[model samples]
Target: MTESNDGIDRRSAAPMYDQLRRLIVEHIENDRLQPGDPLPGEHRLCDQYGVSRTVVRQALGQLEHEGLIERVKGKGTFVARPRTAESLVHTLVGLYEEVERRGGHVHSDILRHERITADAEVARALELDEGAPVVVLERLRHVDGDAWSLSTTWMPEDVGTHSFDVDLREASLYRLLAEQGIVATHGVRSAEATVATHEQAQLLGLTAGAALLRLRSVSRDESGRPIEFFVAYHRGDRSRFEFQLDADSSRGELIRIP
Candidate 1:
């Protein structure tokens, strides 16, 4: 393997292991490493990157957690084969953006997009008075031509209806919101496993009573004002979610969802 001193930058604000992990991903992306190909052993990586074994382990652990690489018993880590399912970290980007970033062909079929009076949940989520105007967006997310998820988003009508005029099937909602000077800086996310309803299954191309993963989120701006409320139902057979927790953060507790 070719070694370059440019791989790690001591002056960078990013952690050393993160940089190393990116370097490895770059190698895979650049065709230097093919799927199922063995990655350099920990000692070799340590020597090549001029980092300690702990750093190497951290990097490897992250790569494995992301499904980019895998470790077999008594065998070194290797590049993982391409996956048919979709996954994303708990980030602010929309589902379409995430799927496209992972090299999947993604598009949305807009089911409902109109101004409506806020229901109790929508009003509470957006901190608006009951029956206030809100823009409701219902969509079926297609990944690789499969209807993978059903999502509904609600935003204050004044903020969403007046500004959102683009073709949502061809645009990202978050991007459109940003162009209008509204950006979500943080969000609260929670997920649960539930069986698909008959209507949901019909929309998602799954059978009724099939397992589903439901994600609910409330996004807010820097001023702590709620910007959007989103709920998504994902096909359990075709989707997953991954989260990275800081080992140093006291609030970083890992919750396993069945």
Candidate 2:
């Protein structure tokens, strides 16, 4: 390995492992290291940073946990390729936004996009009359060329009909809605474990019956009117969810997405 003159500063108050983690992330963000590029081994990192092996390992472990790097069993660690964006369930954000925030490429394959009569469940969720017009959009979202999510969204006719004219391959549904003066301000979401169906498995490149994380949410406008009912299927191994709660606030208990 080439000598690294940018060694950690022992005088800094920050922990060495944290400093190392920052350095690695900086390298990634700066494009000094490309995706799939192998990272220097533990020994090399130790020597380059003038730190102990334990410190090097700890830093690597943290990076792995953060999805910034991946370790191959026999091969060395490499800059991690972007998988599914780690969805924070409590946040009323869309998948496209999450992927873009992480500097990952996102594209969608529109499986179904058309106006349809609202089914009983969809009508109930949107507080619309049964058999009323509703727009349905089904897409398979990809992250860095890998299938990440299979999403199905239903919206009231007035809101969803606009989607038919929009180019969903490149446009975000939420963004399109916002353009039409429909903004989602709040949402109620739930997540559960599920088994993939044959269709889902084929689309996501997994075997049927594979474990998946299924998320359902109902988003509302500023007037508290439900605007959309959304469902997403995420690969259990590729995505993780995190939430931050205030101890003094309501529902203070911590919950993690398994």
Candidate 3:
């Protein structure tokens, strides 16, 4: 709504959609709109806010992205249910175990999990000579039905990928590796906050400039031979990770993975 010749804010000068989003979110915060309360109809909202239907609709979309609102097909937008803390543990567990234990469901969409010749980066990370063949595994991990993360793991080809032919939706890669006499006895992992790259954003279903958690690790056997090097990018909003100074043990000497 705008006022002429008076000391009133001009709705046209400022984006009406942003203004409407602010107004609606404020209502929810101040108790004017409760969780189950129905939002006004699209046409009605336009009339009430003195804006076009386009502006009103776009505003609703913004609220939905912020996780403050949800829209049903036949119904309308409603407040999103509050999210609880998923365990923020920093453990060297299999991706499968970690997701399940954190109260999240896990599934994988196989991208590629096969033996391949290692590049300089992969060979160095896996502690193998450059250009050596390696077992490289790539998969997209889903948690709570959303694509929570994407991972690529590299291992020396001498270890063989045959035993790690992971069932995309069922088996665990780490578990498979252990069963094949390569128990990741202990290893090191590094994590950092980062912005998703163009390629990473596409694979993770994130906006081109979204924030992400890049977790890289190198798991090894008792002999300290680097067996697997992994890199995973997790959605910043829907995922969390934790780090501990040391986890109640000092049997293995700690070293940097990256």
Candidate 4:
């Protein structure tokens, strides 16, 4: 057996694959491996750790499942980029604002921005009559120059007309609304797991049926009037939502899926 420089102990009670997984994780945490860096080939890893092909494969599989590495078909496995964590539990903020606050660059490509008749769902969410005129805004959001999410928002005619001429590529919608005295003071949001559609996959640079996080929300103004309703599809591999819970609260919260 080849001697392992990363301290893979065969005498320990832990399985060989787990030990290998730990070593690889350490290499990543210690900055020996950075995001997008190619991981050693399976055979090379097996030789380095004195393990069989099966053991190496098992260890690699575990790492991939944990989002530590991504394996391309023709291209070898590489360290995966870190996921962006978004706070959804306590804050009423848009993606652009949240990303920028974390020192990340955000850009948007306006896909569609026009006045449209509200559909049933849109009308209901905005508390407007069906077929009422509403502003529809669709954008493909990018983070660090990579496609990250597709967002579609509907706002009341009075509220949305002001945004038609606004440049929103690097601007926050919430901020723009605030300029017009339409601040979103509170909101309800829900998320679900979904697979990307063919069009969505193409725009987001993912294979068809790739995992996505679907988020839907409705924002209200200080006067308790609904101002905006939006649906966003985020790349699941690159996005994570965080929630803070209070165990001492007298009432537990329940999220209803619509």
- State the weakest 10-residue window (summed lDDT) of model 1: 81-90
TM-score of 1: 0.64
Error of 2 at 230 (Å): 0.9
Off-target runs (Cα >4 Å) in candidate 1 are 1-89, 162-164, 250-258
The lDDT ranking, best first, is: 4, 2, 1, 3
Best model number under TM-score? 4
- TM-score-best of 1 and 4: 4
What is the Å distance of residue 4 in model 2 from its true position? 38
Query: Any idea what lDDT model 4 has?
Result: 0.86
Better candidate by lDDT, 3 or 4:
4
**TM-scores of the candidates in the order shown:** 0.64, 0.66, 0.67, 0.79
lDDT of each: 0.81, 0.82, 0.71, 0.86
Quickly count the clashes in candidate 3: 0
Model 2: runs farther than 4 Å from truth?
A: 1-85, 250-258
Taking the tens digit of each residue's C-alpha lDDT, what string does model 4 give over 18-57? 9999888877777677888987879889888889999998
- Stretches of candidate 4 off by over 4 Å are 1-31, 40-62, 71-76, 247-250
Candidate 1 lDDT by residue in tens digits, 174-211: 88888788999997777788988989978885557766
Query: Worst 10-residue stretch by lDDT in candidate 2?
Result: 249-258
lDDT of 3 by residue, 1-258 (tens): 232222214646767788788877776777666655776667767767667889878998788667677555457766755443433335668768776776767888878767788888888887888889897778888776767788887888767555454465766777777777887777677677888788877777665766677888878889999988888887765654544456666455555543
Question: For model 4, how many clashes?
Answer: 0
